[model samples]
Target: MKLGELLAIIRRDELDDESQPYLWSNAALIEYAEDAENEACRRASLLRDATTPAICRITLVAGTSEYDLDPRVIRLRRVRLTGNSTPLVPVTTAQLDEEHPGWEDETGEPSCYLTDWETGEIRVVPTPTAVGTLELQVVRLPLVALNDMEDTPEIHARFHRDLRHWIVKRAFSVLDSERQDKDRAKDAESRFALAFGDPLSARTEEWNARNLPSTHRDGSE
Candidate 1:
């Protein structure tokens, strides 16, 4: 659904009189809509992109093992040297330490990759001796704010309806004299979780623990 259509429903459901003054202004609602899309991307992995060069391609610097991922990237899925058929395997610092011992000081083509989500960096094993490009697949948050004027969300068409649940959740719980409705707000949040899946913060904690290279010492799997 487009932003305009979504806004219309939110207005009607919330008794937001567009003809009259509204507690939930268009600007605020747009922000809420943006929040919902971002949350969906974070928890549900809605946007899986492989071809966006700005986010999916990295230039490897000779002797540089580590590189920053795009800020919007929520998860890194794969990495491959531009012309190589073999994909770099995921590895952990602890695992590397156990096997290679001072692997960080070595130099060669990267055979494995390690990610630290907390720092938004990926380290390629055996810093490259020749500069080249790495192709990537990633899950990322939306690149821009919702263009309430005419643009629709980057979220897929099927998931667009579910996005409204998030907007309603935020809109109703707004701490305003006329707008605050805790019961409805709570209900909306519950429905959104049902539609999108997971309480994101709790899910994030589990995800971080599972993905932390230190925790996954046995990389043989």
Candidate 2:
């Protein structure tokens, strides 16, 4: 759904005419809806991994084993060394140090990788014998935002109901309507579960039962 339409609905149904220009303005609703969309993106893993680089080069410094990854990357799904189809073995810093005490002394195609998530850096043991590409699969944050009436959400239209419910819940909370906030929050949770499927299912059949896909009323899905 277009962001403007979603914000308009929140303003009409949740904020209403009485609170229109005072308690919540058009800009405020747009901001709140964006926040809700971000939260939903994370919760449902809706943000695609398409932004991940096809290859991150590993610099072959004579003495250094570490290289920077793209800052936009949220987390690495898997990484491969040059010419290898399978993902490289992953190792923790502690394990790398323990197993390869003289990692600097070695030089070869990286067989194992260690990552510093906080720094967005990767340490390859044996430093590359030659500079090579680090083929990777990664998750990234969504770039879309709403700044005006024409702006649209990056979220799939299938999840629009959940997004609307989420905005309604946030609207109630911001307005200090405790009872309505709790009620709308519950409604939002239900829509979210329906959109993303139940997380607690162990059996395939049971999981499929709760994983039914939602259809859009606009016939877009």
Candidate 3:
């Protein structure tokens, strides 16, 4: 939904109008909405793995082991040698250095990759002699700014409901604290926890249910 539409929803839900003693202006709500959107985007990316963009492929340059990654990459999921379908073994810089002391000097098809998330760079071991393709799959960074009221969020539409509740939670939190309405603040918190928190729990629970049986479940019975 558009930012304007979301603001209207928040106003109606909170019974916030000029007639009310607590004047929640559009500007204030918009600010809260932006904050909520940013928070929601972060949490969804971390908890839900929300980014599912197409895999990116870069041609390997002979004698080059380091490559600049896209700024929009939030998390690098996997690196593979394109057309081979086999994923590169991810290793730390220390591990790579220990395993292949002359990795920089070596020139062949890269069999491993090291992702430097902090630096936004990827390093390949053994470099490349012949032209080849390196494929990277990553969780994309979210677009946070909503300058135009008509501009919609970059967050997936499926999670918009949770995003809306989070916005309400933040707005009510500020409004309630300002008005000294503790009850209203608690209500907003409760609503947000129920809508957003439960789903997060469900994701964990579903993962455990699917994987725990084979890995961690007691089989003594």
Candidate 4:
């Protein structure tokens, strides 16, 4: 649905504030709509892009082991070099520290990478000596905001309408006297959660993102 249509629905049917001098302004509701859309993406893992240049492809710099990932990336799915066939392994930084001390000082084909959520960077093990590319499959949040009437949500249509529940919750939770409705806000929040369960944690998201099996016994063929 168009942002304009969703806004109209919220104002007319949901908020019942279609009268002049709307209880909630378009700007505030638009922000809430964005929040809802982001929440939907995170909670439902709705968008997985391996083709989007900004979201999926990472250019490599020779001798550089660590690089910043796009901020929208929520979970790293699979990462591989442009010249390689098998995807690189994902590992924890602590594991590298303990098992392969001075790993960052070495230079070779990086078989593993670790994501630093705090730094928003991924570090390749054993550093790279040659220029290359890291192709990534990732689960990401929406890159665009619903600030304009013409903007359409990137999530599936089935979940688009459900976003209204979150917008409604935010609308009622507004601090203004005319708009505040704590009881209704909580109810809407509950309904929204029921409709879209809680978002995945970092660990859970990582686990869900992985698809390749570790051995032939796992039936890769």
- Measured on C-alpha atoms, candidate 4 has an lDDT of 0.80
In candidate 2, how many Å is residue 94 off? 3.3
Off by over 4 Å in 3: 15-35, 46-55, 143-145, 169-221
TM-score of 1: 0.90
Task: For residue 140, give model 1's deviation from the true position in Å.
Answer: 1.0
Residue 121 CA displacement from its true place in model 4, Å: 0.4
Per-residue lDDT over 1-221 for candidate 4, one digit per residue giving the tens place of the 0 to 100 score: 99888989888878998887877888888899999998888777788788999888878788898899898987776778887777777776677889889887989988888777767888887788888889987789987778887888988887878888899999999888988999999888888887788756877755554332121222132
Backbone clash tally for model 1? Answer: 0
Query: Can you tell me which runs of candidate 1 are displaced by over 4 Å?
Result: 202-221
**TM-score leaderboard ranking:** 1, 4, 2, 3
**What's the distance in Å from true for residue 183, model 1?**
0.6
Q: Cα lDDT of all candidates, in order?
A: 0.80, 0.60, 0.61, 0.80
- lDDT per residue for candidate 1 within 17-37, as digits (tens), equals 567577678888889889999
Report the C-alpha lDDT of model 3 over 133-195, residue by residue, as the tens digit: 777655554544666678787776666555666666665566354544556666776775655
In order of lDDT, best first, we have 4, 1, 3, 2
List the candidate 4 regions with Cα displacement exceeding 4 Å: 199-221
Worst lDDT run of 10 residues, candidate 4, spans: 212-221
| TM-score (all chains, Cα) for each model | 0.90, 0.67, 0.65, 0.89
RMSD in angstroms, candidate 3?
7.6
